[model samples]
Target chain A: MSEIIVNAVSKTWGGVGGVDRISFKAEAGTLLVLLGPSGCGKSTTLRLIAGLEEVDSGTITIGGRDVTHLSPAERRISMVFQSYALFPHLNVAENIIFGLKVRGVGRAERDEKLRKVADIVGLSHLLERKPSQLSGGQRQRVALGRAIIAEAAVCLMDEPLSNLDAKLRHEMRTEIRALQQRLGMTMVYVTHDQSEAMTMADRVILMRDGHIEQNGAPHELYNEPASDFAARFIGTPPMNIISWQDGAMLGVRPEHIFVAERNGVPATVRAVEYLGADSIILCDVKGETVSVRQTGYCSLPAGTQVGLEWQNRHIHLFDRDSGKRLADRAPA
Target chain B: MVAAVMTAAEPKTARHRNWATNVNAWLLLLPAIVLLGMFTHYPILATLYHSFFSLGRSGPAEFVGLENYRYMLDDDVFWQVLRNNFIFALATVPTSIGLALLMAVWVDKKIVGRSFLRLAFFTPTVLPMIAVANIWLFFYTPDYGLLDQFLKSLGFAGHNWLGDPSTVMTCLAVMVVWKEAGFFMIFYLAALQSIPPELKEAASVEGASRWYFFRRVTFPLLMPTTLFISINALINSFKLVDQLVIMTKGGPNNASSLLLYYIYEVAFNFWDTTYAATLTVTLITILAAVALTKFVYLDRRIHYQ
Candidate 1:
């Protein structure tokens, strides 16, 4: 396994910075995710570490070796693209063993590695079939097989499951986690999907506007965000950033808010979405929309008066001017 | 009971609708089928039929089975022209295709002045063949031509480019390749652009060298375009006799003459219609055979979908 250390790496295109001085360390045997919205430079950071995109200024060390100026091929890493990018002309086995053959490995060794990787990805029966004959999930497995067959210490995956259907994405996500754990591979995954970051990452670096807004574990990002942006971006139905008394912005997750009888600010229910296991209620509080997520079957009628309440510790106060968290605020 | 009654009544109306649809489809197809029959099928059959007859002067033509064929086999000029056509095809098709692929790759890459290079390469294709031949005639002129002047400046003796039998075919083949490669390059360029750029990035990340990526991924993916360009180049090689007429005129003892050019000389210049018809039949047969081999053999090996 390899520990990836990116130090103040910066890349710019035509005076517009794609990634501004960003630094993080993916510890050995940990799955680190670069999570952000589109155009937030998560993929750019992954590409920089893989040596696909040259860093304008900074040093990157993988396994303690400086690889900033090396070519992608010289870096000891493997990548799975978002599109799977399987060779259309090659069959499954050929696609998997292509890296080995190109490196001048012996045919016997290549075949042996191919079989092992195919078995791991459950693609043994499809070795002779072309990529055109495979389904979306099958093609994703082939891409994974290609990365795993190289046996690199650091594996980079750029939204590998973004092309698959929802059910298959869930299945493949779990399988990829299992595979990484079994092999002890240090992976740097890039995605805009926060759930993927939550369920798969040992550490998530949430970026915004070319800067790392917060870097911590998934639950830490969920419960304790560093800024208003992170507070609204990490969780499903996200956290509500409502103006508190004296113009302080308060951040609280939708799940933490309780529908009370008459203890707090009264709001009107705008809509209710009855998802099977969870129901989300949209409420209007002083012309600001706030969302409430509750466990199954919240059947409140529209335009009904409801009071919102939450524990004092759940309130995250932010400075109105800078959107940064207030240091002096304590739970009241 | 109601469903059974409806099903029984539906058959007659469905049959009537099917018949009406068939008639409408046939009406739409009539124009294309008729035009094709008049221009292509009729001419092919007429040429084959005329090959078996002899032209009689001042009298009705007489049937002569195999006579024209025997004469064609014995004619040295006909044999020479057929051999020359074969040589021209063998020289031009592969070289032009290779050059086209190379030029396409260079253009596809993000190089400086790429648009200008594309325009320069494709200029020869847009020029008419007769005009191109006229321009090349000046280049190949003995002693004072561009090629000879360059050679003379380099301390080498000047040689006859198109006049001598040894260098005539090679000069024509080179000119043909220069004209045709750019046209073929357009097809290759289109095919290359359709391949996702991610494949190249993945290959680079996988440690595949540029040449390895091209051989395993880019080249195989371009097979369908190559087949299409090759067929067009082959057909043009046989039919493109405009250059021969303008530059060589089948000169220096018909060294640069092609089969179609010879057929023109036989029918129009010498008034030998029967011999020309026999030669036309042979040309058609060769083209049909090539097309068949491509469909039956190459199509199986190069999967398009």
Candidate 2:
């Protein structure tokens, strides 16, 4: 019953459309990630759901209640900020129980919940330490702990792992996803990182320029992007968007493009970046930069001529003007 | 070992160079050290030395160790001035700091004419205390003054604002708070601005009321700034006697007289140098105690990152 329905919500901030008519429904006990590049209004949509921001037009409902006008506290929700936003003056234990204290939760219940949350977040020993004393990862755990302790139906996270280092981000990402599942809390996460969206989201709402480009599962967005922007944004190194005649563009994932000695489109290698697990070979095909992802070390020198081949179904066509995907693939 | 010892041994000129460096450092510090010695240390020690002596009338002075201390304890005016100073600090420091914090919060908001509001609040701080007291003197004037005229128009009688024994200290305290709160506000503004806006936003999401957020998060975070402003307000309460000189002159039974003003009166008006020196020692002790409290207690309680 904690399903959130954002109904055609639009929020214009500082003369720019923060989120324009963005509509999506996050089902109960699911992790829905609002993924997009910066300024794509993903965070704005999350804020609207939390009621931190009012919709310029349209409505938002949470847990079967029309909460478009309700303040964040009135709505049964918790949020973890990008900066963690831990109270620097309060110790870790106090920070986690702040919301409960504000709501006048009894001391016994608060302490009991605090102990359980601290054990889950691994912050039992650090209850006495202030936020300043905690490391970045530990601070992030505290933020997560604070949100989870609220026992709200929904937990909204705004790039909770972005402040951490790569290793910590990976660890926290797994921890957060696991925590969400264990608690069965409906969570709406916002981030620009596609890998995070692809790996963790039960459903990913990809946005661009204040509009939802596509809303589906991670692999659905990856395998069948709705437009050139969605196609390029959802994949690693992005889909290579090669322009064709008649205002059409061909989209292909880098991993799908296989490099052979001869048989397909002839291209010359411009550069090769060795990334241990896989090497990305940058090739120049008729002056358009095309990248090919190959397993293992690819030591081909610059100017090495190669043929790129892919299955007919792998190529995605889009209208160059509107950036919309075009069906019925034809020879480029 | 021979080579290590040979390398460790200093050259003849190296020792001379080290001595030269020491001499250069002292040369650079000479002016500052001399000024501090003559103006600060010498005066402090001299005041302590002088407090033990009796004022001489065209003759050599004699040592009167505890005589001045006993007189200070017995002098009703000195006791009244001391008590008034305590009351003045207690009345002004927290009130001004609280008002300063409120003004800072108001000005920090995106309100209309905020820059003008800030300027209006801070203008009193820029004006000389004597000029402010003179301006307020007209406002406090008994019958035809601004306050009295306003009160008369409001269907009430006007009382002597500055002349009344009961109201003199309170009037001065109010004026001092008005003149000083804005100056303290600048520090609060800087501290408040430095607090991340995201914290407030996060608090909003957590459903903390404005007052609750302020009590738990904002106020605790601003403890260092409050301590800083409190110390300044305390020191100013004792040192700022210009308005007392201009408005009340510690008159009408010495109700409004502070310690520093009384010291000035004893030293300059009565030519009791020894007594003034004793009073100066007391003022210094009070200020030193404040500085100690700040460094020892507040600093430990509020960790500044």
Residue A180: error of model 2 in Å?
1.0
What is the Å distance of residue B3 in model 2 from its true position? 13
The C-alpha local distance difference test score for the whole of candidate 1 amounts to 0.92
Model 1 alpha-carbon miss at residue A130, Å: 0.3
Q: Total clashes, candidate 1? A: 0
DockQ per model, Cα: 0.81, 0.77
Docking category of candidate 2:
medium
TM-score of each: 0.97, 0.95
Interface RMSD for all numbered candidates: 1.0, 1.2
**By summed lDDT, which 10 consecutive residues of candidate 2 chain A come out lowest?**
A323-332
Clashes of 2: 0
Alpha-carbon runs more than 4 Å astray in model 2:
B1-31, B303-305
- Best of the candidates, lDDT: 1
Give lDDT: candidate 2, residue B270.
94
CA lDDT of each candidate?
A: 0.92, 0.92
**What clash pairs does model 2 have?**
none
lDDT of 2: 0.92
Query: What fnat does each of the candidate structures reach?
Result: 0.83, 0.81
